[model samples]
Target: MATIFTRIVEGEIPSYKIAETDQFLSFLDVRPTVEGHTLCIIKREVDYYFDLTDDELAGLTLFSKRVAQALKQVIDCKRIAVAVLGLEVPHTHVHLIPVRSEQDFHLGRSIEVSPERMEEIAAAVRAALEG
Candidate 1:
């Protein structure tokens, strides 16, 4: 069975896409920790983040860094916080949250964003990645 992240990577499920490459994909989290919160995942479905091959792991980190940089361009924050909980979903993913203070790191305190706003934020992040 394919994981939900696999479904998103394959377009079986829709996502507010931020960036993509042959090996990885970055997109907005439906339940955002902050307005610019994003998720980065490997195109390959891996159950654990560490289970990825060394090269795959390195690629994921570099790819995530690019996405984080683009995210920073649009989101005002002291830094982009990276989190890898891997408990909410079966697939491996990295959460990139724009953080200004300790409160911004609260994963439990997710915010509900409308579809329109999601689209807008995704576009901004995508544009930043492109430009």
Candidate 2:
């Protein structure tokens, strides 16, 4: 069965995509921890992060680094912190969240964002990525 991340990659599920390559995809986190919280995942479905082959792992991180750089260009945060906790869904993925302080990493402390705002943010990130 395809994981949720795979579904997003395959267009079976919708996503606010930030970037895409042959092997990876990045998108805005619908339940963002911060304003520009994004999720990066390998195109292939893998249950565990450590289970990915070395090449796949490298590709995912490199792709995410590019997304993080683009994310920082638009979001007003000190830095983008990466987290790889896969328990939420059965897909190996990375969370690139904008953080100004230690408290910003609190995943449970998500703020509600309107769908229009989400589209706006997603467009900003996409423009940054393209620029």
Clashes of each: 0, 0
Residue-pair clash count for candidate 1: 0
Per residue, candidate 2 scores C-alpha lDDT tens digits across 1-131 of 87878878989999888888888898989889889999999888898999999999999989999999999999999999999999989999999999999899988778888888888888998998889
Indicate the residue-level lDDT of 27 in model 2. 90
Using Cα atoms with residue i matched to residue i, what is each candidate's TM-score against the true structure? 0.97, 0.95
Question: Candidate 2's error at 63, in angstroms?
Answer: 0.4
Regions of model 2 farther than 4 Å from truth = none
Scored by lDDT, model 1 comes in at 0.93
Sequence-dependent TM-score of model 1: 0.97
Cα-based lDDT at residue 6, candidate 2: 82
Cα lDDT, model 1, residue 39: 97
> What range of 10 consecutive residues in model 2 has the weakest lDDT sum?
106-115
